[model samples]
Target: MKTVAICSGKGGVGKTALACSIAAIIAGDQKRVLLFDGNLGLPNCDVYCGIEVGCTLGHIVRDGRELRDAVVPTKAGFDLISGGSGWKELAQLEGAEIDALVGDLMVLADTYDHVLIDCAPGVGNRVFPFLRASQGLMVVTTSEAASLMDGYALLKNAWDVNPSLTAGLVVNHVGSPAQGRGVASEVQGIVGQFLSQELEYWGSIRHDSLVARACAERRIFASAFPTAGPSQDLVDAANAIMGLGVEAEATEEISMLGRIKSVFGKKTEDSEDKAA
Candidate 1:
């Protein structure tokens, strides 16, 4: 399976909605898609999908439930493994907890063509593991200055954790596609010039009232408004992600990329070595 982590630096960037939209779009193509809510303490992908849930990843970890049994199929054409709403243990997972989660995640992800991980909105320890484990990372940001800076911080820290990470940027809630592309280009060029890491402009979504309406109505935005501009933008993103051509690295080895250093987040001293 090709695991793709979707994250942002701060909250309220519509990352969750975009993740569900992308999942539905990919699943629409007849590919098996699994939308894993990696947000830990505050998981709510089900809310966006407008689906009822019972057992979740939290049950799998906390109560020893089977991974297969915990999976819930959504009306949006994909499966969802949600996270607990306010599990403090889940929020502060470490050591064995994280390892077992990653192990189970990979095992569950094995049954699907794609896994869209809706990670917690930050660069904390809990979020980096998913970033390191995934074959690709998608950072969501708005056009605001602070949002762009925080998004860049997340990218820099992500590369520091996993040097092999291939990243992409998605400009969300833009006034126009050109505006979003410009924002994506600016961030992409900055990362290339400083960190020397490639951040592809995956795609961008416009500020559509339908998106908000879908969220308020507890429905999948793209399915509820397929012809909307933002939905088409999400479709473009899904196609770009499908065409990314993820490398066939062993998942276990990929999970171990920053196992030792990421907890403390120690960086290599030589910047040149990093850029290499």
Candidate 2:
């Protein structure tokens, strides 16, 4: 499966909602999609997708459950692996614990078409593994100054980890087309100037009452209001994400630990040539 890390350095940018929606859209296209909530500290993907928590990553680490055992099917047409809210240990997991989690996730590469990791806000032990292992990075941000700065920080952190990993931007809760493009432009300019990195404009989601209602009701917005403009925007964005092409590892036949390590310990020269 192609793993995509959906992240934002700052919270309240609607990252979880976008990830869940993208999963739902891709799953509808006869693709087996897995949405793994990587926000171990403040996981709310389950809440946004309107699914119940069963076992989570915590189960695998703390309870000795298999990775697949934590899979929960959502009505939105995709499978989900919740990060298990309220588990302080999960939020602070690092080193060997993080390795074990990534190793297990690598085992499911053949089971799904895509695995979208809804990453937690900020960087560090819990988030790095996912970003390193992913073939795609989707940075969710808003026109707000704080979200822009923090989102850029998250992208820069990812670049530091994997310089070849190009990221796409999705400006959420935009007030207007001008506002959305302006946000994308600001980030693009900053990245090009400071980081010398390219950022793709995946598109934007306008603020909508249905989205607010979905969050308030703990449901997926596209499923609740498929006809909404913002819902269509999400569909377009999901298509763009699916269109992203990544060079698959030729040697996935190695051991799970080896495979995960290959990604975690990869060098920039061994990865995509900083192209596209």
Write down the lDDT that model 2 would get. 0.84
Q: What TM-score would every model get versus the actual structure?
A: 0.87, 0.86
What would the per-residue lDDT of candidate 1 be over residues 26-86, giving only the tens digit for each residue? 9999999999898887999989988878887766777777778778998878999888576
lDDT of 2 by residue, 169-215 (tens): 99999887678888898889989999899998988899998888888
**lDDT minimum window of 10 residues, candidate 2:** 246-255
List candidate 2 segments past 4 Å from native: 246-276
Candidate 1 error regions (>4 Å): 246-276
Using TM-score as the measure, the top candidate is 1
In candidate 2, the residue pairs with backbone N, CA or C atoms under 3 Å apart (3 or more residues apart, or in different chains) clash, namely 1-109
